[model samples]
Target: MGTFEGLVAFSVTPTRPDESIDEDRLCAHIDTLIAAGVDGIAIFGSTGSIGSFSEAERRRVAEVTTKHVGRRVPVAIGTGAMTTAEAVRLSEHAEKVGADALLVVPITYWPLNEAELCAHYRAIASATQLPIFAYNSPVLTGVDMTPNIIVRLWQDGRVKYLKESARDLLRIPQVKEATEGRLRIFGGRDDSIVEALRLGADGWTSGAANIVPRACRRLFNFANDSQNEFAAHILQRRLAPLMSFLMDKGHVSVCHTALEILGRPIGTPRRPILPLAGEDRIHLEGILRSLEEEL
Candidate 1:
């Protein structure tokens, strides 16, 4: 169990027009991430549309990603499900298929108390020898894993990293202080990567990396190199608008649309959550155009 650090792409699931997973395109997407020089890949994550995939689909995606990535970069699979049993099953499958680490988001729907959340992660951590990064994304999961809970989990030496998506910048310091810097914190929100880095996050798990992996990589490098002005300029000009749409509309829709606009074969989001239409499309096109100019 070790840390898989640096700019990890929280991958977007590429699908066919009918919403089936597009395996070929997905592999190409992984290739793009690796080629763009990201340190690792986090597949089947929230940005990867894990919520919309069945357990079988999730495992298949992880397998394909691991196979494609091989030893080039570590591949972390999201093994978070609403039930402990399901999460355990997914975690075990990821271990079997050779995942380097697991990003465990809190179970959605039936909100668990802090004790329950700790137990849930402990169970999964015990189930596999693979490293686990507790993913805290309250906006989607509706459950916040407080720093105290994280500290308790870290004490067992099972939870190794944190993908902090809570968007509460204060929680970064709280987690750092609570854990005494034992747990490596990765910024999960794209727009706040620089802010998170300034506040002492170890790295980022970024959705924007889906389209502009090189740019995301550069931002991480710039921050680490202490080139704050250059990083900020890149974020404001190249990354901000797409991230804005992702925050305002929906992550999967915006990410998928951006990929399609960039000529990547990632199809639309699964239905009832359709692609951007009307004014949203115009706005996205403008954003993509602006982003293209920077590229």
Candidate 2:
């Protein structure tokens, strides 16, 4: 399909008070992002808590999101699973439901070597024709798919893009160099967007975009505009506090909490991943308020 670029908001699978996937809330949330002019939307990602949902629920989310999005912008479904069989199944489902791309992360109960990782991607890619955006999230997945490994995967023509979330800016150019500018690299952390742009990243994938889509888009536009470096720097400085808060606390929980305070209220995160509370929530409110003044 088409290449994915620009500000792609990493969605939170909005839940009801009972922790069920609230389809109405999810659709409304995506509509908000689309109205804000996001380039794309990624569901069932780490920020969306893909691991928290069952396979059936993931598929339902994919179906609802693709149905709701309806060619407005590309939809990238996270189809990563603990095993190749599950990943293939999810990837096939994503393709069948009209998803534009697949974001596959290496999920392992134990460590995976380079060969095993390669095999994992190869098998999944064979199962679906949708472009694959390999995810490099070592924190949750415990497998840091390196730039070289990613380059190899890209060479095989399966992986078209990479969502690098390791907080290592070096990987941005490293992946580019390894692949000889073949792989589209996206910044994974909100706080790292500026640096990523400076290093020639194609776009950014952010959980915080759920709360501040307009601001995030403006910042990315400024950064990407080349001649507007001065303006981008000013905007980045103004947005730093909120970005810092998101990176410091936790993007998932903070966005969930911030959404509620803004009155959009996507509902609480699922159990075992509690919503932000107490002083942290208060601090987030203050940061968000100040961010509005910057915009």
Candidate 3:
């Protein structure tokens, strides 16, 4: 699996009514993804409700999922915290628990300056031996990283991969050139996967994969093989509607509802992010049914 480049599903973290992680259901979901041929299993990403869970719950997820996965596919912990100290602590825990890599998003309340940003990354990199994924979702994190800051982190060896979640596809080549082709870029935005891969994205870190994994895998396979301009039919037609519809709405909520509709319910999303219902639930079921037919 050298140079393995494909979909790394940003899996949801299922929780009990008390908000504790349902480790049994969680591992089952990971097994489903591995069975579907996903390239990696990334937990605690935005889809995992990264900010809502306590550090202890995250550790349980990291420990249980990594041990359960047993290196079947790579396991990456999104050790994103609001402060450097907390982030570093989580990074140390992830490495200690046998995680393969770290997705270090700048989980900031306020925007960070370039100097502060570089320093934050430097501190995390120094604290862990695992490869870092520069998770850049400016919309949620509120700190859009410039190429120079990203490149500087790469230069310092703090970041080996980037999840460019910026909706703009131009950042693909921009960072590719800035890093001199040394970094691996994974398209993080759901609606942009096909174009992102076409524009030289190394892989995809998708929330939608939690529902329609084989469909996502097919898109990756088609794009990677090139096949003289063969296109991603499943995504362009079946998948894009759901992904795009969820952009302004709840991704985690949609995923949770989709799971229930698919009959592999992983419980509800944590408190405050209510379950998808009524017309929204009906629409998701329709989407899942159509997508399942393709799968």
Q: For each candidate, C-alpha RMSD in Å?
A: 1.6, 1.2, 1.7
List, residue by residue over 1-295, the lDDT tens digit for candidate 1: 2348899898988888677899999898888888889898898788887788899999899889888888788889999997899999999999998899988997678889988888898899889999898888888889988778888888989888899888688889888988888799998888778889889899898888887787888888887776476756666556777777788887888888877777785888877677788899889888878777444
Candidate 2: deviation at residue 22, Å? 0.6
The Cα local distance difference test for each model comes to 0.84, 0.88, 0.85
Q: Regarding lDDT, does 2 or 3 come out ahead?
A: 2
Point to the candidate with the largest TM-score.
2
Clashing pairs in model 2?
none
Output the lDDT of residue 149, model 3: 80
User: Candidate 2 lDDT, tens digit per residue, 22-42?
Assistant: 999999999999898899999
Expressed as tens digits, the lDDT of each residue in 59-177 for candidate 3 is 88899988998878888899989999989999999999998888889987787999999999899999988889889998888998877788889999758889999878998999998
Residue 26 local lDDT, model 3:
93
Most lDDT-accurate candidate: 2
The residue-level lDDT of candidate 3 at 4 comes to: 27
> What stretches of model 2 exceed 4 Å from their correct place?
none
- Please give the clash total of every predicted structure, in order: 0, 0, 0
